[model samples]
Target: MRILFSGTPAYGHLLPLLPLERAARKAGHTTAFLTHASLGDLVAPAPVLPAGASLEETLDEFHRTTGTNAAEDMSPATAGEFFGGIRVDLGADAALAAAHDFGPDLVVAETADFLGPLAAAHLGVPWASHGVGIALEAPLAEAMWATAAARATARGLALARPFASVDPWPDCLQRDDWKPSRDRITVRPEAHESESGSGSGAGWEAPAFPGREHLPRVLVTLGTIVDDPEALTEIVTSLAGREVNVVVALPPSSADGALPVAGAGVHVTGFVPMRLLLQGMDAVVCSGGAGTVLSVLGAGLPLVIWPLGLDKPLNAERTAALGAAEVVGGAGEAGEAVVRVLEEPSYRAAARKAAADIGAMPRAEDVLPLLTARLG
Candidate 1:
């Protein structure tokens, strides 16, 4: 079977879909990834069909067209305008053209990417929604769908609903009042590592703070999109000052002496895979991006989450409710949160329980048959 995987052009959106994509390829199905060309490197060995504008481009276009700063205003309407309206408007044609060429039996779209479902609808093929994180609020989901439906209607096609949802979020992390919208197929989440072992920091090794071996080690990363050197420096400085060893994961752009807090107790490095970077870390400090939150919890590490924007606030709230993380308002509060998480045993215990629940979910390869069954 030929399967096409699509996602937004960002790590948090794309990486969650990789486990299932890799599973399909391992099962001998022909698979291609559809996203911006800039992310081709992250999904090497699998064919990449470039579609859509980059995140930066789409945001710029949304800002130009709507005269609203997409970054600052993350309301349902504005987010829908950015992700479902402008993104589909700019990339749907390319995505449709590519889908025609690939002729996939199935299209697997990450939750936020509407283009994949649009192409599947045009082609009359079944598509599955692969969730990246916790389920979205009803208003946001409805807004995105309403905007995407407009585009589908304009193209003289009806947007088809997904047959199933491939959810990586474990039962332990789910909200008490929330439920799934469709048939849910639980898949264990794994930290994304490139097939060729050539990712950004593949060969990098964690440094040993020889004298500080007894000190609790914490990782500070803002994920791909939220690159604030000042915030990162403040968090790192705060943690380091508290007799905690800090490791700051710097994006490639900021690797050149951008972070000013690196000192004897603070280590700075480039974008390493979360699987590799989590080694020997006692805890994490992050912006609560889905990828980072899931990876850290999967490793049984507690977190100090200072959400910046987008879905981060929700992710932080959910994880904090699960008792695996602490949500702070700003950088100033992050240090105290991390220290508390380290000193308190409950946080680690909750994280470990979450890890066990996540581990009990079906592996991606095991879910291939379930997805393929929908083809019939």
Candidate 2:
């Protein structure tokens, strides 16, 4: 089978689809990734068919056209316009052309990426929606569908219902009221790693912060998009005074001197893959991106979430409801939350339970037959 995997250009949108793409390849199936050209590196070894503008370009266009910031205004209508309206308006033709060239038998798209489904419908091929983390709230989903439908209508086509929804979130993390509209295929979520291991920080060595070996180690990361040097510095400084050793992961764009001077227990490094960075970490302090949240929980580590915007607030709330994380309002609250998570056994226990639930889900390889069977 020729499987075409598609998603938005950002890490949060693209990384979730890798496990299934890798699984299909492992099962002797041909697979290609379709997304913005810049994100080709994230899905290395799988040939990337360029489609759509870069994420920055799309966000800029959305801002210019709508006169509203997506990050600041995360209401259903605004998010829908950003993801389904502007993104598809800018990229649909490119995505459709790429789909024609690839002629895939199946298209697996990350949730919120409308181009993949649009292309699939145009080609009369089946496509599946792959969940990024928890399922989208109903209002946001309906708004996305409404906008995407309009785009499809303009192209003299109509959106086809997906044959299945590939979900990686375990039941423990899912909302009780929200259910998928199609067949739900459960897949285990793995921390994304490129086949070549080139960009994944595979061999990067963690510095041996000498005397802090005995202290509990915590990772403080705000993900790629939420880079605030001042906030990071404050959080790091707050944690430095505590008993934990802090490993700070900054985005590559952040300069080495961006943060203020720190204690010997604090170590700072540029972006590293979650799989590598989570090693030896007892807890996490983050901005609660879905990828980061799922990765932290999958590692059985508790979290102190400082949600800035977008889907983060919902993710943080759900995670806290599960008792696996503590949601903090600011840098001042972050230190206390981390300390509480470390001292309290309940948080770790809940995280471990979530990990066990994730472990029990079907592996990507195991879901291949189900996807293939849908073609019939």
1-376: candidate 2 lDDT, tens digit per residue:
8999999888888888988998899899999988988876788888889888888898789899989888688789997898889999888999999999999999999888999999998999889989897788789888998999999998998998788999887788777677656599998898865566345686778778897789999999999787789899889877867998998889755766346747789888887888988989999999998899889999999999999887888889989998999999898688888999999999999999999988888989899898788779
lDDT of 2: 0.87
Query: Could you give me the TM-score of model 1 versus the true structure?
Result: 0.96
- Lowest summed lDDT over 10 consecutive residues: which window, candidate 2? 252-261
Q: Which residue runs of candidate 2 sit more than 4 Å off their true CA positions?
A: 180-182, 255-258
Error of 1 at 58 (Å): 0.2
Clashing pairs in 1: none
User: Which pairs clash in model 2?
Assistant: none
Model 1, range 210-298, lDDT digits (tens) per residue? 79888888899999777788999888767757878888987644647457665777888877888888999999999988888889999
RMSD of each: 1.5, 1.5
Superposed by TM-score, candidate 2 places the C-alpha of residue 83 at a distance from the truth, in angstroms, of: 1.6
Q: Per-prediction TM-score, please?
A: 0.96, 0.96
**Candidate 1: residue 356 Cα off by (Å):** 0.9
**Cα error of candidate 2 at position 330, Å:** 0.2
